[model samples]
Target: MTAEATTRAAELKQAQAALQQGRFAEGLAMARALVQDDPGDGEALYLAAVAARYLKDYEAAEDWLSKLHRAMPEYGRAWQEAGHLALARGREAEALAAFVRATRFNPALEASWREQARLLAAAGRAAEAAMARRQQERLARLPRELVAVTNHLAEGRLLRAEEICRHYLRTHPRKDANHIEGMRLLAKVGIEFGVLEEAEFLLESAVAFAPDDVQLRLDYIDALRRRQNFAKAHEEAEKLYARDPASPVFRSRLAIESMAVGDYERGLELFDAVLQQHPRDPANLTSKGHALKTTGAREAAIAAYRAAIAAKPDHGDAWYALANLKTYRFGEDELAAMKEQAARPDLSFMDRVHIAFALGKAHEDREEYAASFAAYDEGNALKRAQTRYSADAMSAELARQKAVCTRDLFEARAGSGHDAPDPIFILGLPRAGSTLLEQILASHSQIDGTLELPDILALAHRLRGRRVGENRYPDVLRELTADQLAKFGRDFIENTRIHRAGAPFFIDKMPNNFRHIGLIHLILPNAKIIDARRDPMDCCFSGFKQLFAEGQEFTYGLREMGRYYADYVALMDHWDEVLPGKVLRVRHEDVLDDLEGQTRRMLDHVGLPFEEACLDFHRTSRAVRTASSEQVRQPLNRKGQGAWKPFEPWLGELKEALGDLAPREI
Candidate 1:
């Protein structure tokens, strides 16, 4: 209405247009002029900060935000923006402090609350994350839509919450703040939908609307990690790390991505440093152990595991790692000493279980079946009694998931002429040396060991309306057309190029990729499917003792691990029967029995020449990030062959399940 106000509004519009076109300097100049005229204007300060951030002038952005905060100390957005800019510059500790300050200033700021939760989750502070989520729910009034939606989320009613969020967005069309909330909810829904691409798209849009929103930034990072875009995820994490240099979270994440990208040594050092700063950090300690194992420092790795166990006696992963080292990497005397230590009465039930599992495998490897049975029997008692899952329900759910994935992968590509890539899929149960095999192959001149990828799972999700673990595929057949497969194949190749930045052949070594063998075969008939089979008991017991942060569902129980392995074997056998030479069986025992022989055969199968380095895979020195990291750093060993024997006396349940060891004819 006023002449001056109209002129200011026009200038603001022009400034916004310039900002939209990324003319940061010009837009920032306009924003400063507007703010100078009205120092109390929050919007002008916000715009100036945005422009400063765009120009990579973090100090300027902070100055603008500080002015806003000084003007209104209780201004929650100001604190939130301070956190955002801090996080953007990789200052986690400061970011955390800022976010906490924002939430303290205004608990009603749901966005700020979620940002804290997101950062906590990114930092692996699950309990803190839960607390934040609960606080968000508590602050909302009931019969309140947000309460109902969040309650549904808490109860795993993802679809209901999603529908509600979508409905809210549709009804409240013009509110940018509410719209952003709706998008955030939709992204969560997409995660539950197991649609990585959809989740990715929704979150990407959410970030576009609120580019400086810390929670949205974190959500974007998670989506990237889920899609197995480690390179990009690491890049985003680098920004976050810059925001909080002292934050252990940044180091931990960098370590994880470094490991993923085959920078094990750097990852190890970072993990070790994090553990040093936060001495009782179980995950960092475990990861550090893995790095040690990878570097062939078996004893040192074991010490780390032991220290982790000492810090947290019930630490399942530490126990598992200790056992693995004793059985696979240690000498007979060291094995005896370690087992004696594990058998101490002070050990927790989980530790005992892990020890038994490890001891059994060790005995079995020494061909002492009776001793192995004893250890397995002891471990089995605790395992069978554990109520981690209801067996019948899990069976049904797993069967349903398998059926859906099978239909999607098999029928959808039944008669299609899609020629798959090298399809060098390394499949087996986790902790069964799949990563070692990949590293060996990858070290070869022709092969690239791409990290544990989720491409097949992502592709499967897109094809069916579900994830690899969910049953949602159509019953009817609809083979992928050759052109479609070609496009998908090329996209897959291009997308995964980051993993194999400089290799001729790339490996998609998702161990669980075993479940998608049918789909893989259909897509890439010529693809070399390397069935990386360790001894059944070794694989089963190994998985049982470790702790995995992601995607080792079968590892929580002995029966579950055993049954999954059985299913995997059955499936691989079917592939052998149906596709014949399309699959090559790489027995871990044989690989150990004569490393050179196995290496030569492995190379021949993958269509590569035998390089001496393949024989000395231990000396290759690339960072390995698997349970077998330590084992691979040494020459092959016979000690792992029948390692289940010592615990055989304890394996009352699994003994029947796995009736006999398949003869070592390989």
Candidate 2:
């Protein structure tokens, strides 16, 4: 070989060795030098891109891969490298397209097909996933035992997979390739089946056996997070971050875990650190903005949100954050931008809801009732679509659990004689005008407006022990004695007292408070319970469109949403039956139809005088976090009452489930 060729070969070998040893910067320098000498070499360019990706230099990786693709369009390795680069940068569509190209170029690439299937499944394109699965099936045949065990696991015949894995472990007695694969299969089955305990144990064992495996550590973190072992998850995340401090993915994971455990300060710091390295990361920017908003840095939060939008024009969460920030830091110029973004048809369903909801509030603030109602209608429609697809038996079960939580809660309060401070609660399905009711009540001078405090739900979750399923409530309640219940109630009051700010009364307007009405009645027998009832179709459909953090699976499926809504009504009816004269049902339509009459009745029910301010609730200066923020800023209108009309033609499936769009009670 010539001297130049020999030197290039030597440098390429050294680069590969450097990369293997995690000396990414050193490897990248050498790889680029080798690539410059051998521009036609696909392997060199691929290695350069891999090094760039490892260094988290997404732009460099993209540039390198783009040139490689241009130079050798049919090169399977270039396509595969591009796919990896795309996935690393969170470009799923680009990744899938590249993977498709790779498979086309080299049909014999078994690993490429496997990765293609995994990516498609992750993206929720089940048909595409099935196609990739077929490719894997056609490429190679597995041993009968492996195939049989995999099939059994897929079918949730876990005992068989366990037996096979155990036998394999016993016979192998070492981490052979087959044994490792079996363990991996075991972990996969556990995760897919939601077998938390088994998944946790298997992941722990896997991590122990392969401590250096990043993927294994990630899997273990996922299992622990699912189990709500936040402390352990945070520790694992910290350890992972220490291994790769510059990895935005690991940093984000740590931030998320910290936020989950109410460590908002630490979460914000971590998020800020992530943004420092990746200033254009829209997700990190949005998260940081949200953390700021929650931590009371309202103006700074708005600025961060704007920065996020500037970086990623289509970042919906940034739009939502800006809209929320405008609540206390109102701006007329920003309103137009908020409205425009909220109405963008190209936005995703959840983004559309957020934008619409924000725009609605902004329009309402300007007293543009027609525009506000239109925004609300669009937002509500998105929520309905979500409920149609996601809600199921799980919602019913959750609602039941919530009701039991309420019962035990109230039973504890029964002996106090005095209702807990801020006894008035507004509860119903979210987007059902609970916020509007709170705004109206807050205008009463007697009531303070506290945006949804999750104190009650948090308290209930804390009281729960090692039990699952529907029947766990009664047994759980039996464990809370009167004294303990009073202490719990007192604790709830103390936590929320900050929001009350010395007001004689405050509206704890958590829409999900419907789940805790039983507790509300028992704790404060005299506490007014306003059940904000909207048209079932409108409410359920609106819920479907919303992307809530919890208790919203029913919103994803029409049948599930319908049944869940029915159960919610049934349980509320039961509360009314057992408690008698406690709940005052306030129809959204009725509130719209006769604002004065409804306002008077609402005030009277809560033992307040009929003040003119109650009639002018739209002018109240309180910050609302609910989707109704916009609508409540305007005078009452019927535009939202029959909102299901435009989408009425497409809601046949839902109509069949709930038997019409008209308001109904079980």
- Say which candidate scores most in TM-score: 1
- Report RMSD for candidate 2: 15.7
lDDT tens per residue, model 1, 67-186: 776445545557777888987899987888788877765555566677778889988999998888777664553325655565466445576887787788788764554677677767
TM-scores, in order shown? 0.62, 0.52
Q: Ten consecutive residues with minimal summed lDDT in candidate 1?
A: 468-477
Per-model C-alpha lDDT, please?
0.70, 0.69
Clashes of each: 50, 32
Go through the candidates in order and give the C-alpha RMSD of each one to the true structure. 18.1, 15.7
Task: Please estimate how well model 1 matches the true structure, expressed as its whole-model Cα lDDT.
Answer: 0.70
lDDT by residue (tens digit), candidate 2, 452-527 = 7666655444444322222344336646556665666676666566456467788877777776665554445556
Error of 1 at 38 (Å): 64
